[model samples]
Target: MKKILLSIGGLVLLVIAVLLVAPLFISLEDYKPEIAAKAKEATGRDLEIGGKISLSLFPTVAIEVNDVALANYEQGQNKDMVTLEQMALELQVMPLLSSEVVIDRFVLVKPIINLEIDKTGKPNWELEGTQAPANETATTENSESSDGGSGAGLSGLSLGDVRIENGELHFIDLASGAKEDIEALNLEISLEALNEPLSLDGRLDWKAETINLKADVANLESLMNGGSTALEASVNSSPVNFSFNGTAQQASAFALAGALDLDVPSVKGLTDWVGAPIERQSEETFGPLSVKGQLDLNGSVVAFDDVSLAFDALTAQGALKIDSSGSVPNIVAALSTGVLDITPYLPPETSGGQDASSESTSDGGGAVQNAGADQGWSDEAIDFSGLKSVNADLALKSEGVKIRKITIGVSELGILLQGGKLTADLKQLALYDGQARGKVVLDSSKATPTTAINFDLSGVQAEPLLSDSADFEKLLGTLSSKANLTTQGASQKAMVSNLNGTGDFIFQDGAVKGVNIPGLIRNVSLDALQNSFDEAQSTDFAELSGTYTIQQGVVNNQDLSMIAPLFRLSGKGTVPMPPKTLDYRLEPKLVGDLEGQGGDSGAKGLAVPLLITGSWSDPKVAPDLAGALTDQLKDPSALIEGVTSGEGGVKLPLGDGDDAGGVEEVIEKPKEALQKLFGN
Candidate 1:
């Protein structure tokens, strides 16, 4: 029995030895040529395969490939040139149980690729080309294999570890003439093709002249029959050091959709990376337009936190939102700041043009004439609906600057400027001590642009406001004024309709400055004029209050009063801006009933009556002395018959009875004759 058992044991050992050593005769070197031929046939290109194979007594087989390279082939190009590096596959056990191959690891290293795009934006790789005979045969075989089962081609392969080192990827932007290259990438993947689900992890490093990036990806998978892919990735770059992780889903070819959340600590570097300058502007210095902030973006939705931009003396910070998905996108942004000098960015005005104050002419004369008629405004009409929303805070400061906000709808009637605020600090504006605040709204819906203006003007010394403007210095002494005004109109012609406002005017001690009634009256006291002419020139006072209203081109002043002259005045006139013309009539009345009072019964006791009637085209001022003289001397010609004409007063002749009409009908008269003879 012992002898029989030993012989049985020996037989069992012999069978095991044969099973382990059988693969040794299957030399991998001998199979290299056939494998290379098959690979060439499959890819339509030449293939080179090299590797070492080993068999162990444990009944295991392992193979390692040093390198595999493929050649590029075209109808007339050099077919021997290497175009791509073939993947090196390493198998630890071949034909596991004699039916499938199990790959323990695979590595792809330092592969170079080239791509070219033509002027027509087509890629060279997409062009049709001839295929080698071996490649055609291999492709036919692969198709037959696929027909055997849905995944039969890849079902026999299993991998434990896969890695790629120092790989490079590049992208060329044909439209922008830019090329982006990513290099120094390392990746590791473990996949089992026959398994239910697949997984992968990769890491990459990218270097460029102005930027550097490193990223990591993990837990990648394709689920629901390739309808969705899930993964987590983090990317870090020198410019905008931030990271994002998310899941993405795709719907056939319609779209690639996903949502990603991110956190960013600082965007200063990011701004710099994008070639945005960082600096500030001073009164004597100019600075970069810099901005920094934390932003969140999900698909088309974006949000900002603590964002600011500095341009010269202006700094603006705000939050805004845009929706760019519709036919007409809209934008809603709110920004605020203390002061801003926006003059540098304003459009250059045409030469020899009328200023803001000049009424708009049919030829586009006012400031709003060519306001936004430029390419910049036209390009801003792109739809922004794809952008979500934003909220922000901001500030700006500048001298001689105008802040304007205008909105125009593509299909709307006209442009609407919600408002505009202007500040002038130039010496000419007297803004050194001058400051003005105002808001103007324009409604262009009408055939003409209608404007509403509300403004507060202060620190305007009358002398300066009128210095270069007119002859105010000749009549009124040094003067200053403060006024609050509101007006609405569609055009110069329409401005006369229902215009009303009030003003407080003050004149310093000096000779009457302008040609107005108050300026001409000087320091005359009615009582003193009646008492003796002595005290009339000694008194000095300055101040006035008045309100004016306009309707149907006629301006009327009901509360015109002055202290130095101590007189009350009423006036009416028409002021049209087109041809720039003014016509008015004024009646001056003494404050008290001097005729009834026990005042001096002299020329001063008589009412100091005055009348003004003239067109701005050519104005004339004279005294109403017709009733002052007795019947025999009542005629102005008789009163001035012997008086020598001087600079202060003059006299002229009167008409004969047949041709002379009523008192109002007398035509020619000397201005001085009326002033001296009537004492007004």
Candidate 2:
């Protein structure tokens, strides 16, 4: 029995010795052709091993291969899809006997991978042959078996160091003409055991920038077993830096709750580095941005609480949540800021200020001329497609807000958007020293978008408001206005042409900055006269009120009324917004005093008809000679009596051909009074 046992031991020893020493005489390179042939049959791609192959066993099992490559698709741009200068792997043989995989070092050196998508949407990574449909029962059984064995499979797994040195990955989309390249990717990973901590550190050069990345898992086993584990990760790059520290779990689904910090030196720079540069209206936009918050991600829902965000010199604190489980993402946010100045991101206001000298002069036939007519509203299409990409509910409050040259104070706004329709409620707003509240609804679901606004403004300072908003600084007053307007269009020109609205406005204790009505009427002449409103000359009034209706961009106001110390004025007009022209008539009557707001019957005086016509930018102001003559003749007895009594409040020159006094000529021949009075 002892001799037989000895024989068995000797045979086992001989087998072990052979297993340890057999690799010395054998050459793995000799079977390279067979290996390549098998790989081609499996993948339908040529696999080439140009250099030497070495293998070892016994104390450590190791394999090394050099100069390996895989052929690209027949229609691929590159000759070789993947190439590796060298690959080496080492494993502990003793651990394999215990159902464990303990890797000493697994390294890949200078591997290049080219991933391409053809113009026909075919990818090079897709093998030539079709794959058989997976069996449901078999797949379910396999998945259950794998899940049941996962713990045991990974229980004894260990890794000393796994590394990739200077690898490169290229991606190209032929249909989109887009290319992306990651060069010099060096990574190192270390795992003592499945139950212990795991760490990874890596660096990559992309788009002429280097990115440093690191991650740590406190307990890899716990994480794999659907339990929570402490996790920390960071990515640092020239354009942006991001870091997160928190707990991660994968119980029913992956989830995380942690603190995240992200800083971007310049969004534009980061976008450019990613080969997706964004276009901005101003150079000042897309500048520095930073965010810090507590993030909770559960399934497809992500929430950020106590978020502090800074962008383009504007800072705010907010809470935001996003749910992507639906067809479109839904966002909810509440933000507040001290002063939100978004002027840098706003498009510049058009240059619309006209010079005072551009007004009508003697050479222009008394017609006011604008320095230059605006090019008109932009016809560029307004893209509302983005609005349909997501649904959002947002509430924003700010101590002050600035957009372009317009400044507003203490505003609270709530916006809700769903299915390409947006409703904005201005709950509270202080604008131009006034209170403004309004609601705006925009529907972009249709082919042609539509907008409706119901706004009310009171006690607003009109001068500064108009100056900043529209470059119209001629009127100074406390203004109150209400408007309910609706329009449908995708472009400014179309919107204005389709506008329909009803509004009423009142201006109190104001002055018309450019014109003195009395002076203009007193200096009446058939020849051209200056009617510029940009000068310091003005007419003070107690009130100016009007109710207007707009249809197809044409505004008509028939009850315009003004009260002044020396005169009462009434006007009616049509303002075509599309053409930016005005056709208005004003009748001003001399009043006895500033009493009863021009309603006192005793304050009536001579009435002169004045006409304002032409573009809003340059209106022509002149007396309606025919209308005035007819008005005076309608009440000839009162006019003559007043003229004889020297209380007509008017003076006309007698004919130059005759030495007739003006009053006598007017009293003697009422029928031909105007003809005689004008020396006709």
CA RMSD for every model?
A: 14.8, 5.5
Candidate with top TM-score is: 2
Residues 1-680 of candidate 1 have per-residue lDDT tens digits of 99999999999789778857776666777877887777666665666754453444343444345455556434322333333343555564436666677776576666644444434566534533345589888998888666554345455666677777777666554655666566666666665654433445555554442223333323122322233444344444443333334444433432222233332333333444445644423233243344455444434545554556554556666654444454434444444343554544555434333345432222221111222211111212222222223211212232233332211111101111222212221112223244444444444434433444444444544444454344333433344554433444544444534344444444444333212332222212333222221212222324444455544434556544444332333444555433334454444322211121122112121123343333342333343334333332545443333232222222112222211111222213445434532445
**Per-candidate clash tally:** 42, 0
TM-scores of the models, in the order given: 0.42, 0.88
lDDT of each: 0.41, 0.81
| Model 1 alpha-carbon drift over 4 Å, by segment | 1-87, 91-103, 127-161, 170-176, 188-219, 222-231, 245-680
For model 2, state the Cα shift of residue 300 in Å.
2.8
* CA displacement after TM-score superposition, residue 179 of candidate 2 (Å): 1.0
Candidate 1 TM-score, C-alpha based: 0.42
Off by over 4 Å in 2: 1-15, 129-152, 279-283, 355-365, 371-381, 521-523, 526-534, 596-603, 636-680
